[model samples]
Target: MNAISPVAHPAPSDEIDLIALVQSLWRQRLLIGLVTLLTGVLAAAYAFIVTPEYQVQSVLRPALIKDLDGLNRTGVYKLTPAQAMQRVGAALDSYERRLEFFRANQGLFEALREPGRSLEQTFESFNRDAFKMLQPDPKKTDNLSAFVGIQLTYPADINGVALVNGLVEFALASERERIAADLATLVKNRLHHLDLQIAAARASYDASKEAKIAALLEADSLKRAKLQDELKALRQQLRTRRDNRVAQLDEAIRIAKSLGIGKPTTPSALGEGERASQGSVIRTEVNNQQIPLYFMGSEALEAERNALLQRRSDDFTEPRIAEIAKELQLLAQNRQVEVLNKRENEDLFLKDLATWREEAARLRNLQFEVAGLKLVSVDQVAVDPLKPIKPKRALILALGLVLGGMLGVFIALLRNMARRIPKTANSAY
Candidate 1:
């Protein structure tokens, strides 16, 4: 209890005093108002001073030649009308062609460049600002209908309409030329291949014909030799039989003389009686001997000769040989037919190649006549736009007013908190 006489209590430092805070802010209301007004003025000035951007746009429809009616009558190109239209549409929508066009006219963007800006930077800026878009038209129903639409956007200050039209023309022409050249080259190559094939086919046909002829000749020679050998063997057998018959008859006469049958006594006795008696006795001996004799009759000999001749003829005109000959004939006919077909095909290809050449020449001439190419028709050409597209002054000023009011309130609260903290520190000391 030594110094417990009177203890002084310190105020709570962490408690929020709402009434005091309100009073402090009220005192600094003038400063807050001044800062808010100044911020609003600055925002308004910025909105008015900044340069606004403007845009010019145009709508285009692909003006491609459909059905190739002009060229179709000549039968030069094989593409159908639908195919032709598709090709044109594809060329129009090609990004590569668009890029090529952009690069080609990159120098045209130099006029839009500011001082101290590099050409590359200017080109990049121009590219970012420009736009090209393609879309299918909703109104068209046909598959081959020319209903595609193209829109191009550019800065309002430049002559963007003419530039876009020029680029479209150039791209279309280049694509056409490229397609024609490719087709012509293809036809030429095919024709050359067909020529080579025809030559090879002709050679093959000739070789086959010669081989068949040689085979037929060899077969005929073999048949003739075989027939001759058979005939010679038959002739030799006949000669041997005839010689044996003569020998047998001579033996029979010798035997009759030995037996003293019909013997002649004197030379005068060699008359009719002796001859008759000798012939009768010789006949009797021939009957008694029982010898087998071969008597070749005139008719039989003639028949054998006829049979040999017939066999010789049959050898030459064998059925197998006839069949082979028939086959060879058919083969020759087929080869001839094949060659004829090839010739016909070659003629057709030649005609097709000629047509391709004519078409290519026509396209070349057409390109020369029309200096630049045109892919599309400008539906609505871009005109000079008067209104700027950027910098909404009213919107910016409204946002600035709201933000400035909030910041002023935050500053007033911070100052009040700062003064309160010092007072609390002094009371603690």
Candidate 2:
């Protein structure tokens, strides 16, 4: 058998050769450089030709105490500086409010519209990307005061400063109007309540007056009844006294007729003759002397009896009768009750009437000059930017150079590998 020679084997195609790759890369260095240069030029063109966007910001802080004096003095609505700042911030952040501003001033946003896009779509995009509300981060140590800001990123050609400033003013005016309207409503309600209270007071006063009048009338009636009863009792007493006197006079007349006495006779005249005969002994003791009615002659008794029988009215006999008549006449009409009934404006005498009216008047005349009232203080107004925020030329150029180098190296590696595949196939054959 002939000795077999060891055949030489070619390197495996899967194995990489570092020296060959390096040589291939050096040979294509011009192509890589060309690609990088092209990319750099393209990036520069983009940086220069593209529309630039500028950022404008308006900062707001708490309003001064004196600035909100007019609003606070009203007393109906009390607002603090922090609360006011919050309200302004809320207004600025409101989407509906933004849309309202946009519709009212359509000319300001004309530049935002693009061809083949509806105004609504353009606004949606602008609202989503351009408008931003800024607040101090709670985690930041430098945040010492409460603040709010409205930031807008807009095209350089547009008047971004004016737009931001206008938006801020619009938000402030809206909040002011809302506050004023709310205060007005509250005041109106308060006035209405006070009017109701006044009406109630008047009604109560009238009721009291009426009750007093009724009491007076009742008292007068009772007084008149009492006087009438007294007058009747007095008349009866006078009549009884007159009848008893007539009976006594009749009896005395009969006794005088029996004694055969025709004229008036006194006991003293009959005793005078006896006392003259029995004189000389003086008695110190005194006794009540009694006189008999029959001593008056029958003619005198008959005449007095006739006069008593002929009497028609016993009113003159009793002085109390006249007094009672006068009192009854006086009580017939209660002057106090009559005067109270005739009063026209009972409210004038009502309790707390003056206080209620005064309060209502004060509410009606209250002044709240919301236009001059400051809800928020502007710490920084929107100003034109010195340069565009977007289209950073240096950064773009650097990124382009890096990306172009990577792409060129990838293409060079692919071409070198493709060129080695044919050589490997020929050696195998």
Candidate 3:
């Protein structure tokens, strides 16, 4: 026969192995039940003995338009509803503010103290673990309005509702006070800036007025000097003309004495009478040359010369002399300069005075009362929860049964495998 090849035998199917495993588990059913019962007991003990924590949430939304109307009307702080919500939210999230509340209301958090921890550390732990800030998801489409909430999980013995509500109130009050203070400070600073501007504008106006006065005075002085110069030239011209006339009169008197002629006789007058007597149409000569001044008689010329020499002032001779004297009198005092110098309130003329005053008045008259100014709306106030949130007994018992069954099955399979391994080794030897 050919070398006895080992007869090929197929391995057991998965179904057969599964049945055997079920049978093995059934054989250790009492042990499995005992382990499961032990686990269930432990779970029950933990579920009943653990301290239950109750959850309380205080919800907040943006204040109504009417509620914030006072602040909006003030115009100093132009806060929108969204901005108001953000302010309250920021105040709620501030750790320093929370600590301040904690310090002030130490009695409220006394029950939260843990052994071996300082008061601050205990409060820190409580703040970190027990408190949660709830906000809407920004990516979601339905989250239109800005809402925020403070959630607190505390032991059943603690007044969680009161605590959470107080926290929310504290945050709102703190934010309101901060807004008021900021508005006051901003108004004060603005007023100071406006005062400085008014002062500067007044100084500038005064300086410009002074400059204008000086310019007017200088122009007046120059004009007066020019008028005086014109008057002097006119007076000199008049004096020289009078002197020439006097000299011409003297020459004319001498000529008349030598020619044996006197008493205002012109050359035309002497010859025109002779031509008329001849009766030949009496033709007289006309020429561009002016008549000589010496034609007047010596007595008349002498009398005019004496009057000119005795004249004290030639101003009456020149019409411009009166005008110059009047202008000089007017220059003695500038009416515009007088008005500017006597002005008492110069700020009224500033370009921005009305605007600055209106703004400052608005700031000063703003309503800063935190009690009336609603910064946020309480959408949901904290209320005592009907049941604890932690130590879910039903879920714990179900989990315990499942886990215990798995553990029992694992132990049974291991024991069976160990016994089979020893038998297999004995048979091989």
Candidate 4:
């Protein structure tokens, strides 16, 4: 083997030299420089010619009015305006419930979906025309309500103020509307009743006066009281008469004894208390003619006593007091029956009157309750925005350019980086 030197070879991609490349670029400097100048100029021209947009921003806070317990307007027990607004907001949110709120917001959907209507119009019409934004949003909201913003864009030499003003009109034009149904309040009612009480009262009033009935009752009571009084007096008179009769009988016996008709000691009349003095308990012995003769005088006195008893029986025979007492008792029973009847009739009337009063009171209370349900306001904000917010064109263009530039550089580098490697060899002689 002859002594031969080995050779190293460079890859095709690496064969490019800095000096040659500079010479080639110098030779094409005019075209290269022109291309760069043209690119920059075109970019400047495009940027300058791009549309300029004016934006309006609206900050919307839900309208909130403070309302107290639906009864007080300005009392201590009232909810704050913010709280009421929150409640309204919640209710508004509940509008999403399709079945329940239709009664309250009737025709609202129709108004919102009106032809040629704007998104803001539909949302703004939630409370119908009762609501209006003092300051509108600058951009279109990406919500179901679709509240919109107004923006104006102008070309390089175009007037921005006019464009923005026109855009604003377009955005604000043709408002969507919904019907307002919150004016009517919720209420519960019960049926009214007053006739029953009135009827009962009238019936009672009719029963209070009756000619025969009054007379019969009065007469019966008077007869009973009079009979009772008379019985009491007769008892006292009878006692006095009995005492006088006893005395008279004793005197008569003395007179009889003087005339030799009976024993002087014999009592012609005697009360139970005076029986011992009158020999009421004495027993006479019998069996001898002489003994009969001796007590003959006592027997005559005893006969006198029997005759007095007969007279006393005749004098006191009529028990008129007993008869009167019986009649009085009958009258009293009749009076009690009448009184019970009267109570039954009067109670019916009283019940009627009570019912009437209760019904009247109930009506009055209902009226009061209705009066108490005063209309209170919830929070509603009035927008007074001085600036417009819309059209983030600058930001959009910047993002677009960055994305385009990254894509351009990545594609250029990918094309230059080849997958295969080159090989070199030296010839043998």
Candidate 5:
């Protein structure tokens, strides 16, 4: 009896259970089919009702001024290709900034909306459907690549392509104006700085000239004073010698009279004769006797007086003074020449500054004209896309069908588990 035992019946295998699960699902096929059909119908309805989005793309190349050789040579400041490219980059950034501004100020996009729509509502709707994409081309070996790809997406109703083009044009125009204004301002500032430098240089030169002239005048004044003092001393000495000679002649005449050699001569007459001699002793007859007392004085005194006269004449005609005067005259002439030269240089500089200013103005006008004509070179303009890029109906329908079938299977499994649970509980009791 022990052996006859439940001759080892193996428990049902996992494969059998899996087969059973398939059978259970087949039994609920109607419910699964209904749910899957409903889901597919709902997906189809959504696909048809939702609006489709269209994309427009354009390719653009920055209009860079490549040949700046002439401009560089003409202007005091030079603009380089790299700098131009930098401006292009800035313009691109400005384009983005303008887009942000458009977002903040919704009224700007009102014209692009449907009739009867408020500006705020239109902006919200447009923002929901519209977007812009800017992609720069990868750098090349030449490093001068300037192509960019732009794309705009919007609902089929609006003119997104034209709007994007207009915005780009506006951005380019603004950028050109900004660059021109900046360049003009820089040129004017440089000219102003040059003017300041010239004024300072002229002022310094004038100060130096005045200082030199003052020094020269002081030296001349000192020399002239010294010579004048010397002349006065010579005149005083000559007067003293003449007086002494007159006194000696008077004394000699008195002595002769006292010795009874001759009649006495009047001192007044002798003094008057001495004065008439003009710096020399004069002989006179006194009571019919010739005194012969005419003193010529030493040759040295005469020579000294003559030398003094010569020196006085030399004071006015001294070679050193003449040389100094000539030097002063030459210095004055040189100063005048220098002043003239400085003025001439200043005038030339002012003329150059004016020319540069005119050039800057002309360049600014040219830039404005160019911007007005064409902002950027479009390699390919955006075209109206024929096909929509959203709401993939086939994929959605397939996913919905699959998901519905899965949900039906889950519900059937849950009900089967609930029934088994009650049965197991009853068995346990």
Candidate 6:
């Protein structure tokens, strides 16, 4: 058997290595102890000294409001829930944009700029991240909402409560603009559609009325003309033949009388039409000619339709349209409000667009006005900055210790492996 040299040992695994490991470690135990003790103390010092950040919380509660349309009071929405939420969420993002409005706006920033403390510096000092929340210490949660959150955060030195309140107001204003803009779009679209329907109805109604009146007047004029022609022809023949002439006149007179008029003792046209002009007749060689005219609705029927259309009888009929149109004599007095509204729908088709655009502009203005904003307290003073939130220090220290111990145990296992040696002569040094 060859004598083994310690430094030349074969791959260390076959021989039991416990005693060697104990001896080796005992030789370096002081170094190992020192390293462990220093590591532990360093960890303890780390827990003690690193700036303990205490998080102050402010919550952002989503606002609930009447529907955007304002017409739909009940929550059953025509828009999908996802869409509504998205639209509202977009508006909220716009509101968040205002966070930069007050402080970041050039004018405000310039105004805030001081020789020693610039706007940038002031901003750095005045505002802070709005939340560093305690992990759900079940004690912090209430039953009303699933949300366990605090949206606002500030440094322990900053005014937390006041800051929270300020953010709330900004959030409210943001919500209002969003609702208004979205609602305006829906309302404008609905109004435009209704306007179109009313216009079409009015056009058809008037056209039908004019046509009926034309037919009735034409009939009345023809009836009057025939009677006149018969009377004139019989009269002409009467001069040539006396006794027969008298009989002919009598027959002619009877015919004229049948049309709700007396014979021409005074010789006037029969009132057989809606208008006097419609009853005009011309005597031709063979007979009389009459032109038909448009028919008018009954007073009651016209009145009812007018009311439904928000039209005045005087507007379409003879009297009122003339009187009121004096102020606006140049414009077509015949145009109805419903018709104008229809044109807005048909020609411009911008009702919804204009509405939403205006709302967006209005919101944009508000957002700008709210820029460079600082959240100050609404009703109360900021609590002392010295009161830092509890940081769960003990828990942190415990985690550090466990991790350090694990590392130590792993090193010991590696040390034990290094002590193993093979039993064969070939493995000897």
Which one is best on TM-score?
Answer: 3
lDDT of each: 0.57, 0.87, 0.81, 0.42, 0.59, 0.44
lDDT of 4 by residue, 350-407 (tens): 5446655665555445322222231213122223223322234455456555554555
Using all chains and alpha carbons, the TM-scores for the candidates as numbered come to 0.50, 0.79, 0.84, 0.36, 0.58, 0.40
Once model 3 is optimally superposed onto the true structure by TM-score, how far is the C-alpha of residue 370 displaced, in angstroms?
2.6
Which stretches in model 6 have alpha-carbon errors above 4 Å? Answer: 1-16, 23-28, 53-165, 180-217, 236-392, 399-429
Cα displacement (angstroms), candidate 2, residue 166, comes to 0.8
Backbone clashes in each candidate structure, one number apiece? 2, 0, 0, 17, 0, 21
Candidate 1 ranges beyond 4 A from true positions: 1-51, 54-96, 111-171, 227-389, 392-394, 404-429
Model 5 per-residue lDDT tens digits across residues 1-429? 365644564543334377767788788888888888888888888887888777887666644454444445535446665564455445544535456546654454655767787655665565555655465545553444655655677766667667566555555566667655765676667657666766666676667657866666566666656655655665565556555654554555455444333433444354443234457676554465443442222343344444544443332533455555555455444454455445644434332556555654654554323244333467677777778887778887888889888887888887766766776666554
Q: Which has the higher TM-score value, candidate number 1 or candidate number 6?
A: 1
Models sorted by lDDT, best on top? 2, 3, 5, 1, 6, 4
lDDT of model 5 at residue 16? 31
- What are the runs in model 4 whose C-alpha is more than 4 Å off? 1-3, 10-90, 96-331, 334-340, 343-378, 382-391, 418-429
Error of 3 at 75 (Å): 1.7
- Note the residue pairs that clash in candidate 3: none
Writing each residue's lDDT as its tens digit, candidate 6 over 70-163 gives 3234222244333443433343334344345445444423433457876555655434443332223556555233122234434344445555
* Residue pairs whose backbone atoms clash in candidate 2: none
Model 3 Cα lDDT, one tens digit per residue, 1-429: 689878665543334377777899899999889888888888888889999988999889887888888777776678887799888888888898899888888889878777898878988888898889999987774635569888998998788888888888888888878887887887788889988987888789878888898998899889988988988898999889888877877787787666555666666775544333555565466867876655666666677778878888788887888988888899888898898778787777778888878877776676567577888788999998888989899999888888888888788889888877786666555
The lDDT of model 5 is 0.59
Model 5: worst 10 consecutive residues (lDDT sum):
293-302
lDDT of 2 by residue, 1-429 (tens): 999998998666686889988999999999888888888888888988899989999999998888887788877788998899999999999988888888877888988878998767878889999999999888774535579999999987678898899999999999989998999999999999988998888788878888998888888898888888898888888899999999998889999899776687675453444335565764453338666777888998899899989999899988888999999988978889888988888778888889888888889999878887789889999988898889998999898889888888888989998998898888886
Q: Name the lDDT value of residue 151 in candidate 3.
A: 92
Error of 2 at 239 (Å): 4.9
